[model samples]
Structures are given as structure tokens and as C-alpha cells.
Target: MTATDGIRVVTLAGEIDHDTGDTLRHALDATGESCPRIVIDMGQVTFMDSSGINILIAAHRALSEAGGWLRLAAPARNVMRTIHIVGIDALIDCRETLSQALSD
Candidate 1:
């Protein structure tokens, strides 16, 4: 029997903006195809703006529609607060670590 293990880990670092958003989006799209569980590791992401949040939201929606899940792992304080302030936390799951997110 073939066990269907569907988990994808995306580790992101540095700033996320219009220039990088497209690259991130493309990467997510490619990864989302095989993994039902998408975990974005943002522990090293030092900066994130509104465009970054939008990219995440868009990916979340796309994955959800595909009967999958999207989650954020270990966002920096500023990134976490931005997500909270923008209410993105209500839409996607956020955890303290990649291990925690994967365990869930």
C-alpha cells in the first residue's frame, strides 16, 4: 500500500515585497500541487509588508479551495503582529515552530 504523506515545507528569509512576492507565489503554487499540508517557515523572515500578507492570504485561499491547508511557522514579532493586525491569523493557522505546525 502506498501511504499518502502530503506535507510541504517552505522556508522563507529576508524581506517580502512586490518583487519577491511573485517568486514566493510561484514556489507555493508548485509546492501546493503535491502537498495537502503547506507549512511556511518564516522564522528567518526579518521583514514583511502588506504585499507579503496578501501573498500569504492568496496562497491560503488557493490551498483551501484545493482541499488542503496553509500554515505559518515562527513568524518574527513584527510579522506576527502585522498578521494579527490585518486579521490574517483568523484566516490561516500560525504556530510557534515548524515542528508544532507539522505535528498539528
Candidate 2:
């Protein structure tokens, strides 16, 4: 994870399933900074399941309640399809590029 202009950019690769859900939650939500704004770089993420969706939902809610927000950036084709099908792209700010997400 790296912070870019106060927006934390977390890069995750590989499949995100039940096995990795808790870890993903921690990586995304275990922030000590108040009002943490984060952009998840999903460009490298190959796949994701419902567990990943749940974790994202929880993190989005937590961040929003804390006056922050979550953005998804550059998801792979398959992952993007899943995100769209699940309606997560609507709930979360999804960008086509990491730079776009950071700027947003």
C-alpha cells in the first residue's frame, strides 16, 4: 500500500475469496488515520467472489461513516464484470485508471 497525495492506494492481486476476505478487510479498513480516503487498485486483481463483495461493502460503509470514501481503480475485465453485475460499481466510485481514482 502506498499513499498518494493523502489518498491511500492499495494494490491487490490474485483471487479474493472467502479465504482472503478477512485479510482484505484489514488491509482496506484497518486505518488509524481519521477520515481516511482510499483508492483500491484492482487492476491486478484477477478475480473476486461474494466474500470480497461483502468486505468491500463493509469497508465502504465504515469509511463513509468516518467521513471518508473508497474508490476502485482499474479492475481487470472479469472482475469489472462481476463488480457491475453486483452493482458495486454504482455504490463505489470506480475509475478506469488509478490516477483518475486518486484525483476523484
Candidate 3:
């Protein structure tokens, strides 16, 4: 886990489903208190399910309510396609890379 500025960059690889969704949630929850921004680097993520989307949405909502932000970085094609199809891309900021996300 590399960080840029104050944002935590969690680089995730492999599938994001029910099994791994909890890990994502826990990670977000753990940082919710101190971090004002979270950047999930999905450049290596090959797959994502509805549960994974739900996790992201939950994290976004939690962070937003706390005056923070949750951004998605470098999602693979499949994940990006799902995000677009589900219209979550409009709710959360999705960038091409971690650098782009950090800059934003």
C-alpha cells in the first residue's frame, strides 16, 4: 500500500466479490477516522461483481458524509465497464491512474 499526499492508495489485484468485499470495507473503515481521502487503485483488478460495487458505494457514502472522498483509480476494462453500466462512475470519481487521481 503506497500513499500519495494524505490519500491512501490501495492497489487491488484479482477478483472483487463477496469474499473479498469485506476486506475492502474493513480497509476503508480502518482509515475512515483519520484519512480524508481514499484512492483505490484497481489497475490490476481483473473482475468485479455487484457486491464489489456495493462496497465502493458504501465507502463513498461513508467518506462523503464525513467530509472525505473515495476515488477509484485505474480500473481494468471489465471493472470499468461494470461501473459504467451500473452508473456508479457518476457518483464516484474514477481516474485513469493513481497519479491522475492524486492530482484531482
Q: Best candidate, lDDT-wise?
A: 2
**Runs of candidate 3 exceeding 4 Å displacement:** 30-35
Model 1 residue 49 lDDT? Answer: 87
Task: Evaluate residue 91 in candidate 1 and report its C-alpha lDDT on the 0 to 100 scale.
Answer: 95
In TM-score terms, candidate 3 sits at: 0.92
Off by over 4 Å in 2: none
Model 3 residue 101 distance off true place after TM-score fit, in angstroms: 0.4
- Would you list the rank order by lDDT, best first? 2, 3, 1
lDDT of 2: 0.91
lDDT of 3: 0.87
Best by TM-score: 2
lDDT of 1 by residue, 9-93 (tens): 8889899998799889876783426446678899999888888989898889888888888889999998899889999999999
Error of 1 at 56 (Å): 0.7
TM-score of each: 0.88, 0.95, 0.92
For candidate 2, the 10 contiguous residues with the lowest summed lDDT are 24-33
TM-score preference between candidates 1 and 3, better one: 3
Q: In candidate 3, where is summed lDDT lowest over 10 consecutive residues?
A: 27-36
Q: Per-model C-alpha lDDT, please?
A: 0.83, 0.91, 0.87
lDDT of 2 by residue, 6-103 (tens): 88888999999999887888889746778889999999899899999999999999999888999999999999999999999989999999989988
